[model samples]
Target chain A: MAMIETFGLTKRFGSLTAVDDLTTRIDGEIFGLLGPNGSGKTTTVKMLTTLLTPTAGDAHICGYSVREHPRDVREHISYVPQDMAVDPKLTGRENVVFFGKLYGIPRPRDAAEEALARMGLLERADDLVRTYSGGMRRRLELAQALVHDPSVLFLDEPTIGLDVAGRRKIWEHIIGLKERGMTVFVTTHYMDEADHACDRVGIIDRGKVIVTETPGMLKASVCRDIVLIRSDDRFKGTFPEGVTFLGRTGNELRFEVEDGDEAVLVLSRLFAENGMDIRSVSVRKPTLDDVFLSLVGEQDEQTAFDLTRFRTMLRRR
Target chain B: MIRTLWYVERDLRRWLRGRINLLSALIMPAAWLIFVGMALPIRFTDNYLDFITPGILVLTMLGAALQGGSLLMFDKILGFLQKFLAMPSPRESILYGKILFITLRGMIQTTVILVFAIILGAQFLDPVLLAQIYLILFIFGILLSSITTTVALTLEDHDTYAAFNAMIAMPLFFTSSALMPYDQMPSWLAVLARLNPVSYAIDAIRDLQAGIFPAMTLAGLLIGAFVVLLISVIIFRRATV
Candidate 1:
């Protein structure tokens, strides 16, 4: 059964629709909402977390309606917001304990301690959050979210702005949550991270989900494997039956082939028979970045301008 | 209700850790009491300290309430309020917790000011009258805290909130009977003082000090507190996001 489901979930700020008819289902697994800045990812997370009421439609968590039963939905889920929500003046243990109390747990102290231990923050749990590093603060936020043992967890850009090592640590813990049967729904801008961490990735652009599929399937659906053939002469002749010419840059000719390895062998033989000497041949698989770019298009000047304007509005607010 | 208490407890712990703020809260009222009591003439009572203690107490409560609203503003800016909004607990719990914490801080400041007033030769009332004074301060604390909370939730930035606080705080204090008797003021000023809720509280406290029960003033304070609290809750629910 789907633990988190949304149907036509929409939010509007005056005339601008932040989330437009968003419909999706996330089961008991790691699902990622992938988008760039100003793509409505955070707005959708806010709606699901019950921080903002949708202008239209509804969402459900663990069979509870978000609009009709927000409290019940909150009981079954926990949210780690994009911004740092932990109090810097309080200790890590105190932060988690306070969250536990807000959740009305039976034993807030034990729950806080256990959560800190899970995040490997037990030793420094007594220290003020101001004394902790950025990575530690992010881990503490996760610990606070998990103290109540929520079945589903929503993370908005969980590892954003973190160093590579810090990002890896957070990813390891998130993957561990999946292993423990927690339904994890996260939004992120890093395509590579989503490819590796999420069981399924939904590519959202301009407040609409463009595609939803496994990482490999998403890549495959956009463009096939590419076989790069570098030769002294530009190959402008007809291609093989299974190989289609993609593009050429300088002395290299690129072709989209069903099987890159087989195409390389066939293309090399064809080049030699055609009296053309090949300099180098390489087969490359398409990455999620390629898929994302193809689907969302390159970041144009208008999109960049929109993002800056959006950030300014947010800051003013 | 337990959840609300938990928030109050957390806030109290944080407030206690902020020793500098606590010290300042205590010192400001005492400074006002000493300066105003010594500088101002005493016409209504035999001792200036005795005449102005209730007014200073109300001033302390107002400052504490403003601080509470500032704290809420910080919580909103820092995203702590988002955490509370997203939680499973009732939304009213957050407002109640903040109000209770502000009232408790006001009460503590009131006590410290009362101690200083006594040391400075202010008259003491009977036990019953003292209890009534505390009750009046409590009601005033609630009223001011609610108003501040509503303003903080309504304004978007701290600079605007600070401006609004400054715009309202001094006028409310100066126009009230905090520094003088209501009858001693000009007719127009006396009318404004009569309309101010702080005037009612200070008047009630002064009446209680003179062994006169202020039934109407107490009832007015209660109704005013209730009305402002309802408005704060409504604004809080709408403005949290």
Candidate 2:
């Protein structure tokens, strides 16, 4: 059974379609929503979390429709919104206990302490949250969500504002939640973060899921095998006819072609014929972002971003 | 229930522990008691403290009500209400916690005022009458808090709440019999007092202090309070997004 499902879940803020005709299911260990800001990521999570009602369509959280069974849907779900959710006045432990009570858990104090320990906040449990750093509060937010042992956890930008190490620690805790049998539905801005954390990712834009697949499958679909070619900042100079230039980063040239399976052999022959010493070569599959951009027409591109202004062009019913 | 109680307890600790909020809460009320009482030359029928004791006790609730909208604003700003809403319990638990805290604080403040009054030589009415007075005060506290909670839930900022205070509370305290005896006021003012919820609260409290049972006054006070609470709940449910 699908742990979470949304059928045409639509939300409109005035004329802007924040989430439009979004149908998705999270049955995997971890599911992700990858998109740029104002791409309806937060709006989707807010709707699923019951913070806002859908303008149209419906969502089923743990088989309970968000529109009709909000309480039941909420019963099986835990949500950690992108914003600062912990109270500044309360201690880290106190915040956990309060949320635990909300989650209908037994022995809230102990549950709070255990969650705090899991989130690596045991040392700062007694300290007020206002005294903690940003990363610490984010961890506490995650801890509170897990206090009730919810089956499905919705994390919106779990590590968006964190430093590198903080983001790493959060990822470890996220993996920990999955190991404990919880289905994780998360959204993030960083392409690499989604590629790493999500077992399967769905790239969302203009309130719709452009594509959904395992990171590997997504990369494999675009670049069947990986061919690492070294070129200096020129797309036109590519020697291979079938090889299509994806882009360039510094001195490295990236490509997506029909023959990704025999990438190494094809690259060696090309380099050998040219009598050139390769600076550095990498034959790896495409990243999810590559497939994401392919399907969604480059979600991060300025042209795609400028489409947000069209939100105001919408007329009210 | 415990979750809601925990929030109520947390808010109470924060309010009582924070030096600035506490100091202002205490000093402002004490200053008003001294400044207004002294400036107006109002005295108790028997002892000055006795006559003003009920007013001062209710004043704590009034003062607290003025700032009550602040918690909702803080919840909205801090994003703590998100956690509370995500919890499986009825959402009313959030509002319930705030109301419970206000109710408890009202009693505690009244108790403190009575203690301080006694120390300063204010005698109690009959012990039985004291219970009636406290009951009247409790009902009034609920009404005052319900109205304030609705405003806080509806208003987006502390500035709006402050504006509401200026627009409503100032005029309310001025027109009510909080500072003067209703019987001694002008006829037009007396008519306003008879209809004012604050006046019913004050009248009910003063009547208890005056050693009168005043069954009808208690009934009127309760009905007024019930109406306010009903309106508050309706406003709260409607105002939230």
Candidate 3:
């Protein structure tokens, strides 16, 4: 069964459409909702996690409709929200145990200890959360979400705002969950994280999923080899066959096509045939970020509100 | 029910271990009782402290309930409310458990104040009067905490909760029968005070402290408690947060 399925799931914030007509299904795998900042990534997570009810449609998690059986949906999922959930006044251990008990995790002590140990926070468990670093608080938030061991994990920008070491630590823990067969549904902006961590990536833009495909498949579909040419002047030979001609800059042309080795050789001679010698030639492979930007760039003009909110949040950070 | 109880136990233990919240919870009421009661000597019909004791008790209940409300807001801002919502406990049980915890917490604070009052020579009630006082305290706690719980559940912001507590605190205290006998007040004031449920609570407390167990006072307090609890539950059940 699909771990999560949404049909026309929509949410409106007054005049603004936070999420619109979003329909998609995520099976058992590390599915990344790849978007830049806003793009309704958090809002989508909120709806699927049952934190915010959809204004228009429905979402099912672990085969339970978010509307029909919210609790059942909730029982099958764990959400790590964007905010650092630890109360500064409480000890780290206290924060985890408190949420553990609430999540119906039996033997809260053992669960909390295990969580702390997993995150390397066992010795600092007695320390007040106020004293912990930002990364540590984020770790606690993660620990709180996993205490109950739900079937699906909803991580909203789980590694956001963390330093390199911290991000790697959290990623390692996520890999541990994957090894245990937990179906993970996560969202993030860092292209490398998705490329490294997710088996499939869903590029969400303007409150819609542009495409859901394996990371490799997505890259192969949108990006193959980047063709760059630096000419003194004049147009190059007829646009490279089966190649996407990206815009050019000052006597230079760029495009993407499959079979870079053959394509590069053909392009080199083609420029030679045009009686123009190229100063520089380079081939670029597709990164997840490029595929993401291309899919989102198409409708980027319409979703101005997402950009505005993302900017405001970024300014705060 | 069991899950909620465990939640309550975990929360209470965690909160108690946090000195800042616990100390403030106990000290806020103590300060009001000792400082405000000492400064205001315009007695109603009995010991001035006794006259205002019920109000202080009500104040403590309100404070504790506000704490409960803030805690709810914290859960929301932090996303722990989702954990409870995910559970299969009766949907309304969340409200019930929270209200119960607030009510119980209010009762404990009231008893501590009562003990302090006794130690300070605030005068003892007869056996029946003591029972009536306890009964009145329970009703008042439930009523006050219920309102706070509803407000807290509906609101997800701490600043708004703080502002609400401040906005309601002074008027609920100064305008009630805590400082003066309802009959001794001006006609216009009496009419308004009668409408304030806080007045009913104060009157009930004053009746208990005066060594009198007026059936009418007890009856009014009970009805008021029931109405407030009913309204609070409705508001809580409907609130999306």
For candidate 2, the lDDT comes to 0.75
User: TM-score for model 2?
Assistant: 0.86
Q: Comparing 1 and 3 by lDDT, which wins?
A: 1
DockQ value for model 2: 0.47
Q: Residues B38-102, candidate 2: write the lDDT tens digits.
A: 45665445455666666777777777776675676567666677766766787776777787687
DockQ of every candidate structure: 0.50, 0.47, 0.31
Q: Model 1 off-target regions past 4 Å?
A: A229-248, A259-283, A299-317, B41-45
Query: How many clashes show up per model?
Result: 0, 2, 0
lDDT accuracy of residue B241 in candidate 3: 35
lDDT of 3 by residue, A1-317 (tens): 78888899998765667788988888767889887655789888878877677889999899999888888887778877766666786888888887677666669889988888877888999999989987888888777777777789888888878999889888888878878888899988899999999988888876777888898898888868888888886764576568777878887888777866677788888778888878988887888877877887644355345666554332211
Candidate 1 local lDDT, residue A275: 83
CAPRI-style docking class of model 3 based on DockQ: acceptable
lDDT per model vs. reference: 0.87, 0.75, 0.76
Q: State candidate 3's DockQ.
A: 0.31
Per-residue C-alpha lDDT of model 2 across residues A1-317, encoded as one tens digit per residue: 79888888998876678899998788748888887667888778878888778999998888888899888988888888777777777789888887777677778899998889989999989998889988898999888888887889999888977899999889888988898888999988787888888899888877777888888788877755556667543433345677766767677767666667666567656766666566666667677767767777644445544444553321110
**Model 2 ranges off by over 4 Å:** A12-16, A220-274, A277-317, B1-3, B38-46, B186-188
Model 1: lDDT of residue A301: 53
